[model samples]
Target: MPEDVEDPMDYIRLHLLEKLQVLLTTAALLAVVYFGLGRWFRPADPLGPIALLPGGELGKLLGIVVVLLVLAAVAAAATTRSRPEGALMTALFGLGGVAMLSPPMQTLFWSYPASMQSLYLQMMAEVLIFAVGIMLAEGLGGLVRSFMAKICPRWLWTNTLSELSDQQRKTLKKSRIDPMWDKNILNGDSLSVSSGVRNTLLWNLLSLSLHGKNRTAAQKQVFRGQLHRGFGCLFSGVLAGIVLLVLLLQSPERGQILFALFGSFVLAALFAHHLFPVRTFFVAWMIPMLTAVLFYALAAISGTGNRPQYQVLPIDWLTGGAGGAILGFWLSGRWREIRIFEALAQAPPE
Candidate 1:
């Protein structure tokens, strides 16, 4: 096989190991923070009274185990070809995380000593906010994309395609030379190539058009068209961030709430990049950062008395947005590969 064509089993094994490492590392860090450092950072629980089991420390350990199991399941599911299943699992995990963090549930299940309650609450709150943000952004962005694809002007898609470089166009054309190309590529109804070469070509073409240097006039036109379409996602992300901000405002920890807002913005942008046809990294990163900054500026200007100091730092914003964008790009590529695999699996035997 070509070096670029990875065996599916190898891919699965490599990613599964990575996920396990991440899961283990995260669990260990959490344990250290909760058990080792909890006393040092103890404060009043901002989330207020939480439920706790009668079993004390042992019960908390069990609950933590359950949470880890859920996370493991999510990670495993994410590596599979079933995007819907992965997304559903993620949503469920998010919901469960939030419920577990709730005051009643926290009191009932969590074993944090009174001194550590504040720190525990803070940790769980961060997890809950991230989960909720991801669920909402991905779900809402997908819905919006589907809706827009149906009603949006044809010019957008056409212009975007027209922007492809000659080389990229040739690659696309070459991929479509097969007998079943019309039933697949043109219709956008099915995958045609058994090797996934077509999908790879398409992905590379788009990436080059969006990110490659020395773009021709046509490529620039495509970039503009993509930018226009990407505005829909930009709007969607901003709206989602605003909603998260409002929800977070209800929480007692104002600083953490703003942090969640920033997180939501990043998630929104990542979801938008993954779901929308526009594949540009600039759009993926800048839209969310700009949206957050714009909202923050407006809030600062409008507020009375001392201007509210924005809690989100530039380093945090850059890191989060860039990380999310890179992940989105990677996922997009993986999805293309998966699509090719499926198409090949379904194609009639020679």
Candidate 2:
């Protein structure tokens, strides 16, 4: 088993009922937000419940998506350790949340009414808010990971003489591992030696403690450093989206603004794929999800902007967030092999 298995889902085998409860609880929370947002942002002369292509029809399609994938999650739960199950759950919950787009969320309005142009602007702005917020949360998680690292070094343990293969011995020779750890801790044929240190992580959600000294320390640093770089991707994405939103806001043909929005998502996803090294991609996607839940409260406080009066289907915040999340998960993964690929591709300047 890969040592990176510290997330809540890792405990599925340990606590099946708790994981089930968590899933159901998330679904229940989203349900509350669904009808609650429906009433809060409903139109004055409300549109029919079953109306518009992107409204009810798109929701039905997403509902189909949720149903199909949820079964996948159930099967994944039955496994000993399904690595992809985490990603599957991320997609399921992300899409499941977005699948509940009601008429209220579909049609937005400001202090006055929102023009078609303003609606696109508002939508893109919501995307920015979500993109930034998720990255910020991730960065915070990273900080917590690094903080836990100081305590982790105390729990360090080393493997024995027989445990070290020819390859492992060669690996150990070049590193900073203490000779004392290997010599003083030896007894007979035991593989590893442990002192009076707790082997579990202080916070599993942020950092998972691995079984060995080298692997745990190495992966924790990877988690800290790699997660920090996601902000660069986040900055690039936010900047690209903002610049496009500004330029398009002035254009006479407002439909073109969606191209900017689409391009923004595509560009951001590409940057993250290339740059944000993921020991785990599920968290990257998971962070940016529930955009509607994250931002609807803000919209309520600031007052509404653009409430669509027609039988129109404006793409809501969830579209960018949900779609972006799925795309991010699909595109990103561990970067170790990527480094090898880079080393082989070309040489550095002399």
Local error of candidate 1 at residue 26 (angstroms): 10
Q: Write the per-residue lDDT of candidate 1 for residues 274-311, one digit (tens) a residue.
A: 45544333344445456445544553454311222233
lDDT by residue for model 2 over 1-350, one digit each (tens)? 12323332442343444344435644654464355533443323354222222122434333333432443333223321212322233333433333344334333333225444444344444444434433333333333323433556322212113343343333333331333223221222111211111111222333343433445554555444544654544545444444433453343122332333344444454455455433334333433333232333334444453322121123333333334443444333212222222332233322
TM-score of each: 0.39, 0.38
Q: Find the candidate with the highest TM-score and give its number.
A: 1
Candidate 1: what lDDT? 0.38
What lDDT does the true structure give each of the candidates? 0.38, 0.35
TM-score of decoy 1: 0.39
Which parts of model 2 have CA positions greater than 4 angstroms off?
Answer: 1-220, 230-263, 290-298, 307-320, 332-350
Backbone collisions counted per model: 8, 9
